[model samples]
Target: MSQKFPEVQGGGSLIIAWQVKEKNVLVVGGGERGIQVAAGRILHALNADARVTVVCPSSGLNDEVAFRIAEKQVSHIDRNFEPQDLDAADMVLCAVDDPEASTRVWKLCKERRIPANIADVPSECDFYFGSVHRDGPLQVMVSTNGNGPKMASIIRKKIAGTLPDNTGAAIENVGLLRKKLREVAPDLKDGAKRMKWMSRVCESWSLEDLVEMNEADMSQLLDYYKSGEVPSLKAIRDTQ
Candidate 1:
């Protein structure tokens, strides 16, 4: 007999981390609010190596936008948005205050099957821009499914405060350890066994311990993995 999965029933937005690297993103607006959104998109593009273009009629730019432009991080077209602008865009952001213009962009995105977000107008958007918290490579985004952005911002701030400062470094160290472990041990070729071993290693070390680990400490960890000798909780805690 086949198993039946439960049907999902909700109006909530599906949160996901999109890979925008080396992709084209279009922002249709360069006003105050639009510039703010464009600034964020540009930063994301910089980190992900994506290409960004902002379409607006005004020469005036916010300080952030101006800096990114000067740094050659983003391109700007000084003109009103045209339907043809959506032609090679992987994603689009409609930040124009004009309802007609926003609707037009939204419709074009839908027709083209491109993901889009219309600033402050959730009804016309395929997605909402949520508040983000970053700790190195760890990124957390919070949203209220377009119902309450202010609330999302508040929650994101609270959550950000709870994260450890060395989260990014710790994650990188773990990646290196994982790579080393795979290379040294051919016996742990089974995916499940590898996962179990990783879980055990993580259980022995706290976030602080992982952050404090240097080259010598990583060498000791590799030794433990090879010898099949798990370090005591007290020994691990002492490093912190």
Candidate 2:
């Protein structure tokens, strides 16, 4: 609360937001921590439709996540890092526990004006990654804003349990309803209306409740979810 940058107040977690949406992220580390961070990078990138490139030496992980990154078409540099490694990066994460190396990466990023997060050293980070829970594309990132990572993580787990497993399935059916509504509802083209509909659907029909419904039921559900007017049929015909 006192600082401009988001950081875990206890100093273990740094809290900051990096726009991983459609932006490339470079995670530099090869240990278990590095692998953990890389997975988040991959999921966030997949959700945001972004690209990911992982940079690390081959010494750390006994597992195959490093291999998976290559197989997944995520860009990878399978060796030690150099200062030039950061120039083209949109966001940087120094996940190694080694202070000297992370410091080197952090300094270079700062000098080059790139955003970087230093793991194991919250005070050194520019941003913090929080615990998250997702329902289909309904993703929520929980943070103490860096004040309390444990608290943030606890809240995320609690929220996760409340979210039904079939929430993701219901989301897909709603996606179809939205596509059809976009065609029929011209007056509802307002951005606010559209966002409100999404929020309303999330609240009313609710992802948890819709899991039992089939496709036809979902479409009908969305219809009743929208305003009763349903726009003019002439509006639908005009484009044709």
Candidate 3:
């Protein structure tokens, strides 16, 4: 008999890791609170490699926004949002203090089928920005479905504290090893073997061991893989 599966109960937003590299992101803000909100959203968009454009008046800009604009990290439209502004927007973050303007942007985005987040208004948001803890390429996000952002931030901090400082470095080392393994064993038939080797390496080595592995150690790993063996952490590091 097949194993029984647990029943599902769904009532929450779908969490996903979105890759917005080189995509167009529109950030709308105005007034004091709006600019503060816009600054954070702009930073995140830039970090994601999105082509960001902020729509706000000069008076609305905070120091961070002013600095980024001066640095040419993002383009600026020194005016309130217009319907034409949504023309090339792949995604939108609406944080304007003006409720009417926020609603208008949300409505237009809905009609255009662009995903949008209307700050602090769960009903209007197609997605919520969770509190995130980042370490190099690693990112851990916590969400309360836009109900408790402050609580999410607190929880993220707790989680971050428990992780090792060199966790990201270990992950980077493993990634490099994967690439070398692929080059040496570049056959469709060896896919499962490669996966097994990687899994064994991760399981056998401590975080510090993985972090200390250099390019020479990586080459040693490939040598062991060719013989259908996963070497101990000491064995690989000894080659260096």
Go through the candidates in order and give the clash count of each: 0, 4, 0
- Candidate 2 vs candidate 3: which has greater lDDT? 3
Task: Report the C-alpha displacement of residue 129, candidate 2, in angstroms.
Answer: 0.7
- TM-score of each predicted structure versus truth: 0.85, 0.69, 0.95
* Alpha-carbon shift of residue 131 in model 3 (angstroms): 0.7
Compared with the true structure, model 2 gives a TM-score of 0.69
Query: Model 3 over residues 3-43: C-alpha lDDT tens digits?
Result: 48766658688899888999999999887888898888898
Q: What is the lDDT of residue 34 in candidate 2?
A: 62
Better of 1 and 2 by TM-score: 1
lDDT of residue 236 for candidate 3: 65
lDDT computed for candidate 2: 0.67
Name the runs in model 3 displaced over 4 angstroms. 1-3
lDDT (Cα, tens digit) per residue for candidate 2, span 30-78? 5666667656655565566667776776566434555556577577777
Pairs with steric clashes in candidate 1: none
Candidate 3, after superposition: displacement of residue 25 in Å? 0.4
Residue 228 of model 1 has an lDDT of 58
